[model samples]
Target: MFVSRLLAMCFLCVLAAGGTVAWKQRNVTIDDKHGDEVTGIAPKYLPSHAWSSGPRDGLNAKPNASLAYNGTWHDSTHWVNNDQIIVNFGFTGVSVYVYCIIANTPPGPFFDAFANYHILLDGVFVGEYRHDVEMIPDYFYNVPVYVNTTMQNEFHNLSLVANSTERAVLLLFDYATYTVVEEDPVVASTSTDTAAPTSCSLLPTTDQPTGNSQTQIEVIVQVGAALGILAFFVLVGAVIFHLNKKSRTPVLPGTTLRHISRVPRHLATFYRKIVRSLTSHPGESGGVVGDKSSVAQVRSQNKD
Candidate 1:
């Protein structure tokens, strides 16, 4: 039992360590204008001239102070074809997020306009996002169009493609964010010429997601599970120990000389008197001087 309790405490300590690890990881953002980190290509059916990139405020619109890093974004304007603008990026993390400038209830012929985009993770369709007409605000900058929190901590591919045919559709991408687990820094005795790449762009070919992030709920659940397993083992061990200790004590099957020796002297004497009275013949009320049958029977039983 003591050993089990000690193990349970150790298990709890491990869970605390896991929670600390989860908390240490932080989100890293990658801007859409990072040409080397992200790839933006239009469908072959569409001409290259349709693609454009510039400052978000260049359209005589003010930048939302609380949103959009650097006020720079990528978009395609005045395209009517079904060709989609696909954005591809590679990151090393457990979760991914895509931010874009989406419009809802815009003026002109697009008052009820809506846009759709298909999200693919690692070449497989994960989900789709639809910026419906009923969505709040006229424009949403730096809004998360896609979020995927459940993923393994490794190098992964993410793709976002415009899927709508509406002329009012807006795929104004601003940035992308993902989470990576933090690794403990290794200290070397001497410095080297090579250094680690700090950006997600370098992750695809040169580096891996050594540091990853986790959701609060996932961390809580992991800790809870560890504690549950600890409790179960502790209870089982305690019960088994108790039973084993109890089994070691001998239990007599019937009354024997050893058992009588364990009893008090007064109790043993009283018990012997009762036995003698029961064995005495009914004809003999007084002390037996010579009763052959009774004496022989009692003596034989005592000898046995």
Candidate 2:
């Protein structure tokens, strides 16, 4: 029984370690990331005009694409139909919301500038820009003159498509801006744990009194478990010690002289007195103490 109980305790310890490891793995998740535009990409980007680079055409985000050489910007410098304004936005595969800015020279027709172009996300047509034409060429306001992709989830390469087939009708790259949308961790991350609350996990580690109380309770349980293990080990040790002591004693079985010889030395005198009294006559002795069978047996065994 002692050996079995010891083995069971060792098994429980192994199970405990395994359970801890599993718990750590279950609740762990990579954090969600959120931020703005080309900052997330490497090398930022440089404008790669599909047709030809007009002098002073710098591709950059926001007010950065603020100016071009002549009269701020003129007459289709980066023609949407003929040119692919390659904005090498750094990273890919994550969700992001992109806003494309289209600008025109002062006095240019506010609505006419948006008449003939569409935008592509990695080569697929998401929508057209002329849908929301801004009506003021007032120099600084780069309005969403096209598809306002407020929540387009993912994109790597942004391309602009135009309506003109043979002749390059005008439209320019006003610079595009994108912001990373914080996305929840992948579904696979949440599958193993169903977000259940367990009492054992309520151990507090901070300033809240409730948490502290829970932590105290957990500590007590751990201490109690430790003490129980110690007690079990002590009990098993005592049993083994008793069995060993019994094996070492030279006591023989049933009615043997060795059994009588093995009696404690302190009891030997008393035993001798009893034997002498039994053998003596009842008149000479103080009394006859044993039953008849016992007396007969003792006399027979005396070999006298």
Candidate 3:
């Protein structure tokens, strides 16, 4: 039994060591030029009355070498004092990154040039960033302003807000990119016999479980089943060992057999001897003695 338990523990350890599954990853980019046109993920700007309708010309507007995602971006006219751009997107991956542009500035020690911004995910504040003039000298296009790598793989609400309104700090929102974990396609089993087709709804898949959650569930079920099987085998082994040991044991004797062996044994015999006058006594129909004592008396009488 002890050996069986040890074997079971080793088996469980092996399963735990090799239970991990490798998942693939990819990146999905959403450009700011077509924000409103996109389905289900349009960026909604707070206080809609303060923004412009089209991209207006600005100082050194174009990137150095077509660096912006898809050669398009939203200028600083889109957002101003305390304005927030909110987006609700679905992902099945690890990280999310926010990109923007910094327009060219004149030679001066203006404190407004150093802008401050805040990022929030799922209505919780994650972090913030400040644009420094010494670090970023000239007009920098398509740069990462805010990045968050610690988000669960699910549908989330992201908010990008301007924290500083000093002299209307320039904020060029270009695009955003999120890391996506691509799942391997499941191969369908085919049969020769024909079957009826199934129906599926053409609705959004935001409510469905992602690959990460599904994989985790599968692993849990598999481990539970394995443990159950191990327990069953261990119980069976213990029962068999008990039965074998009982069969090989010796049984003790009872009191009735001992009493029968203790009973005594006696001997029986016949004597045919007579004295000198016994011949005549025989003719007179002599009676025989009933026990050994009479025989002894007769012998004594003959002797007298």
- What Cα-based lDDT does every candidate model obtain? 0.62, 0.43, 0.56
Better-scoring candidate (lDDT), 1 or 3: 1
Q: Which candidate should be chosen as best, given lDDT against the real structure?
A: 1
For candidate 2, report its TM-score: 0.31
Residue-level lDDT of model 1, residues 139-222, one tens digit each, is 777788899899999998888776565654556677788888876543322224554322223122324422322244467799
In model 2, where do residues sit more than 4 Å from their true spots?
Answer: 1-90, 93-115, 131-137, 145-155, 165-168, 180-208, 211-304
Query: In candidate 3, residue 270 scores what lDDT?
Result: 15
Instruction: Please give each candidate's TM-score.
Output: 0.46, 0.31, 0.45
How many steric overlaps are in each model, in order? 5, 4, 0
**Candidate 1: stretches off by over 4 Å:** 1-24, 35-48, 56-66, 77-80, 105-113, 134-137, 166-168, 185-304
Instruction: Tell me how candidate 3 scores on lDDT.
Output: 0.56
The local lDDT score (0 to 100) that residue 116 gets in candidate 3 is 58
Candidate 3 wrongly placed segments (more than 4 Å): 1-22, 36-40, 52-55, 58-65, 77-92, 104-113, 134-137, 165-167, 186-304
Predicted candidate 3 versus true structure: per-residue lDDT over 1-304, tens digit per residue: 4356446656755544444345787777766756522243545555455433224453334444366666665544322455554333433457888887665553244323445567877788888867665544566766787787877777666777664645445455677778767565432223335432222322215577445545666898999999999999999999999999999975433343344345442110112233222332333434442445556766675566
Instruction: After the best TM-score superposition of candidate 3, give how far the Cα of residue 142 lies from its true spot, in angstroms.
Output: 3.0
Q: Cα lDDT for residue 279, model 1?
A: 52
Q: Residues 1-304, candidate 2: write the lDDT tens digits.
A: 4356446656755554344322111111111121233343322222432322222444221123335322132123234344433333323333333333354332232223333555566666776555323555433334454333344445466555555543333444333344444434322222346642222222224655454456666899999999999999999999999999999986333344345567886665445545555555655643465647555655565554
Clashing pairs in 2: 41-90, 129-146, 129-147, 204-211
Write the candidate numbers in order of decreasing TM-score: 1, 3, 2
Q: Assess candidate 1 and give its lDDT.
A: 0.62
TM-score (C-alpha) between model 3 and the true structure: 0.45
